[model samples]
Target: MFKEQVLGLMDQAELQIEGKRKEIDRIVDRNQWKVIRAFQKHKVSDYHFAGSTGYGYNDRGREVLDLVYADIFGAETALVRPHFVSGTHTIGTALFGVLRPGDELLMITGRPYDTLHKVIGKPGDGLGSLQDFGIRYGEVALLDDGSPDYESIARCISSSTRVIGIQRSRGYSWRPSFTVAQIAEMVRFVKEIKPDVIVFVDNCYGEFTELTEPTEAGVDLMAGSLIKNPGGGLAATGGYIVGKAKYVELASYRLTAPGIGGEVGAMLGTTRSIYQGLFLAPHLVGQAVKGSVFAASVFERLGFVTHPRWDDPRTDLIQAIRFSGPEHLIAFVQGIQQAAAVDSHVVPEPWDMPGYEHPVIMAAGTFIQGGSLELSADAPIREPYIAYMQGGLTYSHCKMGVLTAIQNMIDRGLLHLEDN
Candidate 1:
C-alpha cells in the first residue's frame, strides 16, 4: 500500500489539476478525430497492414501509410519507415538530404538535443559531420526566458543559409518546448527575412500534443521517432519525416539511395504496428500529458521546482523536476524504475551513454526498448540535478510511477512530506 501522505498528495494534486485534465481531453478529442479522418480518407484496411518482402516495391500499405501521415500533418508528403534507427538518424537524414557543401545550417533554437552535437560535428573533426562536409553551421541561442532570439536570428541569416532548424522539444534542458503557434511565428519571421530558406523542426517528443503540428505551422520539414508520441507505445521501431514533397524526397534519397528513395525499403512486418500506432497516438499522448501535469502538481506541492508548472500550457510530454542534488535525483529515477511493469527489478545507474556528453541515468522499463511513450524518467548526472519524466500508456500507471518516486525519496530520508 502507498503511504497515507503520498496518497494524500496525489489526491490533492488530482483535485488541483482537474481543469488541466479537461483541457487535455479536449485536445485529445480533436486530434483523435483528425487521425481517424486521415485513416478513413485513405481507406485504411487490414490489407494495408500486410507485410512485404525484399525490394518491397509498390507496397500498397506503405504507399497508403505515407498518404495518411501527409494528410494528418498537413504536409505535401511523408516518409515513415521502420528502417529509421532513431530520431537522431531521421533528423540527420533530412539534414544531409538537403544541405550541400557550400550551404549553411542555422539553428534558431539554443543547443539542440545532446545527440545532435556530434551530428553537427567539429570542423575538420574527420567524423564526416555537416561541418566536415564543408557545410557551415551557426546558432542563435534562446533568450533567458527560453524564447527565440529574433534579433540574433535576423542578424545570423546570410546568403549561404539553407536550412533554419528548430527543436520543438527541450531535450535535457530546463526550457519550455516551443508551441505550434510559436513555431508558426518563427516560420513567418524567417520567411520575411529570407523567403527561400527552408524551416526545419526536430519534432521529437512534441507530436500530437496540440491540435496542429509544426508541418501545419509552415515547417518545411519535420522528423520524429515512432517510439515516441507517434508510436503510441506499439511501433517496434521507426521514424517519420513530413513536409514539402521536395524536401521529403531529398531526405528519402539520404535514407536510401539517390534513385531509390522511399520506394525500395521493406516494412518487414512493422506495417500494422506503425499504422495502428498513429491511429492511437493522440489518445495515448493525452494520457502521457495528463501524467506530466500530475507530476508537476505533486512535485510543486513538495516545494520542488517543476518546469511548465502543473497549469502551464504543454507543448510536449516531458516534465522536468529540479532536485537539490544527485541523491534526490537518483532516488526519484530509481522510484520510477521500481514502479515499472517491466524490468522493475533493475536498478538504473549513471553511465556514459552514447550520443551524450555526460553520464546519464535512465528508468526505461518499457515493452519496446527506449519507448518513451511508456512511463519513463531519465536525467544527466550533473549539477542542478533534474530528472525528466515522460510518457505513460495510461494515467494510472503514470500516477503510480510519480507516487512511487516520491515515496522512494521519503523512504531514503531524502524527502519529507509534512502537513500542507
Candidate 2:
C-alpha cells in the first residue's frame, strides 16, 4: 500500500529521477576509487588495525589513520581523534591554537553555524571564548542572491586578520552550501589579498559528498565531526583536523598541550572503527547523497519548495524542504523520529537547545547520539518553516523515512497529496 501511494505520488516522474540516480551512482564509483587509492598509497596493513590503550604514542593504527586522512585531503598532516567532543570543539581548538590576542577572525561566508557563536563570543564576556581573549570577529554577509560578496571580503582584510573562515556546509541556513570549486576560488582570492592569513574551513556535513574537498582547494586548515559524513555511521564519537603541517601541529597542541600534541591520545578500542568507517565512508556518503536527491525530487513533486532541486549538483548531503507552516515542519520531524532505529518511542518538541538562537526541534534518533550520518531531521522554530533533513546509512532506509514523513504530514492534515 505504501509503495502504491509512493508511486501514485511520483506520477510518471520515475524515469527522470532514475536518470539522476544513475549519475549519482557514477559519482559513487569515482569517489570509491579515490578512497581506495588513498588507502593503497598509505600502505594500510594488518599492523595498522591494532588499537592503542594508554598514552597512545607511536601507535601504528593511529599513525596510518592520520596518513590516510592527510593523503585523502591532500594535506601535510591530519589529527583524527575520538577524544574531541564535537565538530564545534574541534573548530574551537583550531581557532584558538592559531589566532592570538588582538588578532582578527573574519568569516567570509556570512554568519556561521549557531554553535560557533559562543566560541566567537561577545567581546569581554566569556573567559574561554576568543572574543574574551581579545580576538576580534567580523563577517561579510552574502549578497541578496546568496553569493559571497567578494568586494566586502577584500575590504574586510587587514593587517590584523589571522584567519579567514569558511563554512563549507550550510548549517541551519537556507542558502545552498558552497561547492569545492567555489571554496577553492575563495581560497585563491583570500590568499591573494593576505598571503599570510590562514584559511580555515568548517567541513562538517560536506566530507566525501563530492569528488573533491576544501583542503584540496588550498584551504590551510579544515575540521569535521566523526558523527557526520566521514564516520560512515560507524564511528561512535570523534572529530578530525587536517591541513598544512604547521597548522595541524598547532591544532594538535591545542587538542592536547603545547609539547604533547597528537602523540599521547589513546584510541580506546576505536582505532578499528575509525579506520573501517573511513573505508566505508565513500559508499555510505553516496548512499546518503542518493537519498537526498530522492527526497528533493519527491518533495518537489508534492508542491513543496526544495533546495538544489533533483538534478542539481550536490556538494553536501543535506536536503532542505520548505513547509507551509510550523505544523508541517513538526509533523515531518516527528515522522522521521518514528522511523528511527533508536529512541523511536519518544517524541521531540521545540526546546531551547544549547548553542542555538531559537527553540529547535530535532529528531536525532541515531545510535551514536546526535549522529547526523544516520537518518535525522531538525529545524529551528523560525521563518519559512524549513526542515533540514540529512543522512541515511542505506538508501532504502532514507526512502522509507522520507515516505513516512510525507505520510505523517498527510495524516495530520498538514499536507494533502491529492490537492497538490
Report how far residue 66 has shifted in candidate 1, in Å.
0.4
Poorest lDDT segment (10 consecutive residues) of candidate 1: 411-420
lDDT of 2 by residue, 98-152 (tens): 9999999999988999999999998889658999999999999998877799998
What TM-score quantifies how close candidate 2 is to the native fold? 0.97
The regions of model 2 sitting more than 4 angstroms off are: 1-3, 10-13
Q: Give the TM-score of each candidate.
A: 0.99, 0.97
Give lDDT for model 1.
0.95
Top lDDT model: 1
lDDT of the candidates, in the order given: 0.95, 0.89
lDDT of residue 143 for candidate 2: 86
Q: Any idea how many clashes model 1 has?
A: 0
User: Local error of candidate 2 at 41, Å?
Assistant: 2.2
